[model samples]
Target: MTDTIFSARQRLSANMRWMRFIVLALAVFFLYSLAQDGFSGRDNVESMTDHLIVLFFCCLHIVFYIVFDRSKVLEFDAGFLYVKSKNGEEKVALSSIHIIRLSSIRLGYIRLWELVYLDEMNNSKSVSFQPLDRQVFSRFQEMVKIANPVVQINRFRFL
Candidate 1:
């Protein structure tokens, strides 16, 4: 029963983010050009600074994104959920799951899945995931039910 896999990854609104960055960079560049000083050498310096600023921000955004999202590799196998990330890897037996919740929506998919369960330490732990596809999303729900039929699963239906 270990069929869960990621069909997609990365942000669904990835295009939108790049679009915003492009627009912002263009606007900043135009402003810098308008404020160019009398000395040609100074003007060149201003332009270079503007370019550097844009590159700095764009690289910063990418770096932050990689650092945050690169941590987690999620999988499901034999009624257990495996989470391998920068922090650490932990497995959760489906039978131990007490709650399943899907929160937020984007492009016809769930943005977040919250699972609350007791881990091997018997301490309540909650894990949240951004499911990659509808099939994976539905399959996880079905798995939870198969593992513990009485478990509470709260799903959303949009008209």
Candidate 2:
């Protein structure tokens, strides 16, 4: 079998979108404060503090986007499943996955949760990852089915 790699662009979650909005609001407030003070001609201390606070919040928002906004794709090839990220990659042997759980959220979103067998300590470990689109999830499910037909998948419940 040939090894394959799949890559997809990640998007911010709904929760992150709200966070970005809050950051934008804070930036606007900071600008308004500066404008009210006649382009910051006076109140040097207050202006500096306001500008610093705005800068910190803007940095926080940017950091969050960098960490979570990228999409990840699952690759199954040559008896291995690889989870790749911008920083690094993780690989799990197909046979080592004890369980493959499928869960859905808000109607259309599918999350894949894997319970993997740790070879070093002979213990089980759980990990979860989300695909960029429903089609990707479907492809993942199909690949898992073909590779490990009897793998048990726990249904995810939300409440």
Candidate 3:
């Protein structure tokens, strides 16, 4: 029996847009204030520190969400990987794939797996998601090799 390479049942990329928007709002609010009044006086300095603290906590929340907010994954028994994300659902056939480009995308301190598949139509589709389990990601990598031996694997690094 062929095992599932990758599977996600819940919306992994869902709620991401809202989180980013919240962070952006915090930045905009504080940045405009900073521009209006230059850093001066003890009271202004104290107020700026308080706002900075709020910003730091907001960023921390995002980091926690990225690391712990995992999705549910069952199986892809149909020989197709079913993806349900913020962008909706899509299924890519294993056999119709000509290339599987592997990469990573980062939002804040977290990193997600990026898969770009070249389908039979010569079109490329990309999926960015965190696997339900780390073991699943390793298994998926091996499965990619078995499915498309000539697939291009990119080694991603953060400096």
Local distance difference test scores for all models: 0.61, 0.53, 0.52
- Candidate 2: segments with Cα more than 4 A from true spot: 1-56, 69-72, 99-128, 133-136, 145-152
Question: For residue 117, what is the lDDT in candidate 1?
Answer: 88
Model 3, 44: alpha-carbon shift in Å?
Answer: 16
Q: Estimate each model's TM-score.
A: 0.52, 0.45, 0.48
lDDT of 3 by residue, 117-153 (tens): 6555768766555545556555555665677677655
- For candidate 1, list the clashing residue pairs, or say none: 71-85
Using TM-score as the measure, what is the rank order of every candidate, best first?
A: 1, 3, 2
lDDT of 1 by residue, 48-135 (tens): 7765765676566555455445435567665677766657778778799888776553424426666788999999987666666566
C-alpha-based local distance difference test score of model 3: 0.52
Which candidate comes out best when scored by TM-score?
A: 1
- What's the candidate order when arranged by decreasing lDDT? 1, 2, 3
Between prediction 1 and prediction 3, the one with superior TM-score is: 1
For every model shown, the clashing-pair count is 1, 1, 0
Scanning candidate 3 in windows of ten residues, the lowest lDDT window is 3-12
List, residue by residue over 36-134, the lDDT tens digit for candidate 2: 665647767776787677667666656655534443445555455665555566676666666665544332443444444444366676544554455
User: Pairing residues by index, what is the TM-score of model 1?
Assistant: 0.52
Candidate 3 deviation (Cα RMSD): 7.5
Clashing pairs in 2: 10-71
